[model samples]
Target: MAVILRYVDNKSQVIERFMGVQYVIETTSSKLKESIDEFLKLHDLSYSNLRGQGYDGTSNMRALVALAKKNSDIGAFFTMTNSLVNVVGCSCKRRDALRDKQQENLMKAIENDCLETGQGLNQEISLKRAGDTRWNSHYDALISLITTFSSVVDMFDMIVEDCYNDSAELDDCFAEGNTELLICLARLSPNDSFVAFDKEKLVFLAQMYPKDFTDQDRSALQDQLDIYIHFVCSDNDFSQLRGINELAKKMVDKGLHRTFAYVYLLV
Candidate 1:
């Protein structure tokens, strides 16, 4: 389930922002819908307030799209535009079909290898156990010499191969699944619960920005972060900021605005 928050300026320009995401153990869309409704009701929000929604191009979101079509203001967009990445990571209809076919072929290959291990000429019970545990050590060597290799290869050859596969790119989007970059990120920022950036990539982006940030821009940036952290941590009405009487109270009171935000279940 996901919660989307829409930020509207005084001029009424609506910019949708991602507030939070919650992973559910349920597999079906119906069950997921029920869970989402329960979560929103707990936070005192109704479906009527949602402005825009982002989704992973899944069946659940597909159902949401159909339901949302009945509502004029709701905007739902499928987020995965890259096909290569979708092949491996997508839970969408077509991509899932390809993954299932690949799994069937892999199981066939493993079974054929196991049968060859059973018929080994030097196959003592202990030696067979050793071979069973050490399949990688002898895979190319023993499997190459085996007659079953030709059939297994032929089975794989018949399937349409995805040469320029983008699954690796899509899988890289998840920080935990990509090992090398995530490892370096963890080392660089040891205190963060999860590292979302690679140092080199971040360094390149930082270099592209202007060296000097303007005073107006800096003040706006500070208030944005300050207000965001204050709202998330305290869960109090933003109207309270205007009512505070202390140092910088006059400054804080000016830009403060009463806004409605989704109190999402954060990880």
Candidate 2:
């Protein structure tokens, strides 16, 4: 692996130097520390002098996975889903059974006129196995599970009738206060001609940040919002904007951001 050092010199300019690479048998934490220590010693530098560190994309993803696994429910769900994929895809016979079951269900639905038929619709899909290092794999696995749920239940019935006999229960992840806050926040969305905008909710949101906005600022914000909403709704340029990102850019391009500073800040 290679190392680089970045520091500010006496001239108040930033400098970065590429330190040579080191060969190591493993990339484990201990092995990497030893290699870095050797490099520091060779350069007459001390590890204690370092102030900050950086990680690459792979390292960041691994850290996210580790953090997410701390939630017991999330961790248990992933574990169960992984095991379910393995059990269902253990052999060719089981896989074939799953496919046949899906096909049978599709035919029944088609006959009952319960499903729409199109050239590109009703394609067969298999279960997706998630990976440890990539978080998106878990999402793909969950979608696959949803699509193949009925067939999976049939497979489980053939194998063990009493496995997972307990009824599944769902827990509410958000409380009432959080739900209200989320709704108020959603009222600020600029999508669909700013149809979600609510002047009262915006005022409530401003009131929450007492340190940033005082009673006078909140009072002025109400009038500013009235004019701001009128200006954006009637203006052709703002009407076509898709999301908050485009709205923000257009506001700057048209110099409206400064005109409605409080409104833009809330956005």
Candidate 3:
């Protein structure tokens, strides 16, 4: 987790500064508070004067921070957009197909005078998984989605068209799997527990704009983080991450605890 300290300095001017990041073995409310206390003690900072607390949606975390005396909010909007990106960008083959289709559409549009060539307008555009650190990431994703909607649908059609048996896919989209898939998608979004994947990334973005972090980034980070988590989950190399929690348990059972060497190398 990352910590930023905000306060009125000796001159009575308000100051907010980065206190650096720390890792915790577990994210339960109790462990997080202990980590914070340790961080404050290590840095010789006082926690008594903390005027408020800020975080993305997590009841336990809020309760943990409340010990420091605080208030909070949640984000669910960006979560939906991230979900859309995942639904479309599940594989590199699909992503490449989407880009190829996008270029074809762009060229056709230009030929028909539907789109004009300009400085940034005609440049190669790709589907960007949302990012909170990038300025106007939401805006860019919105524009891309609108422009590439047809391409996205076409690519998905092409991918599924080759499948000899698409009965399972059809079932998932239209029948018994529909409600379960919807609920699963909702749970995978930034508003749910999966936002934990991008916790530190969100913190960096949040710290970049502290005032806006409370106002906007708090909500936007969820969307970007959801996109990130989806991408990571979709990647083959990171496939093992899907079972990380269970793997940790197995490691514990095997007596292969996280040693200093193991943690150092992992970091």
Candidate 4:
């Protein structure tokens, strides 16, 4: 860390001069004081010239943190989600097992007339592992995990039957109460108004509001919006929306600012 000495020069103007940086070997308050004293000494400066000082200190001892780890539902959810993802995504073989199992389930659903068939419906979709800098990655990972849940728990069951390795990626993946956590998170979702794709969805819905579009026009608008979102979201320039609500408001203001259109109600 860099340390600077603050003092008024001979010109009577306050000036902040850059002092040399020192590598800190210890972090205790006494040790930090010693380090500062040594730093001043190296510059042939005296502590008597010091007027004010700043030091790192805790503001309060309260630990009112999000996802408090001391035995809460949120902590359990985090632990369960993390452990399950680690166990399932640990190897390509396990991931393949999950996909195969999901495919089998999908086939059964289609046979029972529970799921509709379409061109891309049977294509393979696999698990997503979460990353550090992205919260949405965790949501995606959790969705995949839930979709492949029964198959994954079966794998965990098999692992425990053979030989469970507590230190390995399977740690706590098969814990009994995790199902509740999974169900809870699966039902919880952020409001659609803030989702990036939701702006187009809302606009399409507004176009169907009986004032702007007929039935045929609504379907056409839906297809057009789908294609447009697919194109823009794929392009690097329009992808990764960071201000969806602001953009939605701007669009509404542009179209329905002074009009008696029902589209203004959509905003």
Best by TM-score: 2
Model 2 Cα lDDT, one tens digit per residue, 1-267:
456677899999987665655656776878877888898899999978898865335775465566567768878988899999999899898899899998998899899999999999989989998777765677679888998898899988976743443322212334555687778777767788899999999899888778978999999899999999998889888777776778889999999889999888776
Q: Write the per-residue lDDT of candidate 3 for residues 1-267, one digit (tens) a residue.
A: 656677898999986554555667876778878898899899887777767765424552343333222222213445566777887677887778788888898889989999878877666666656554432354577677777788877876886775635866776667754564344333323222243443444344345446545655456555555454554455444444333454345335544343311211112
The lDDT per prediction is 0.39, 0.80, 0.57, 0.57
lDDT string, candidate 4, 39-115, tens digits: 88888988897888754332211121121344377467767777777887888877787777888888898899998
Could you tell me which residue pairs clash in candidate 4? none
Residue 156 of model 3, lDDT score: 65
The local distance difference test score of model 3 is: 0.57
lDDT of 2 at 199: 96
Residue 19, model 4, lDDT: 56
Cα deviation in Å at residue 23, candidate 2?
Answer: 40
TM-score of 2: 0.39
What RMSD does model 1 have?
29.5
Q: Least lDDT summed over 10 consecutive residues: which range in candidate 1? A: 258-267
Q: How many Å off is the CA of 188 in candidate 3?
A: 48
Model 1 score (lDDT): 0.39
Look at candidate 4 and tell me the lDDT of residue 152.
Answer: 78
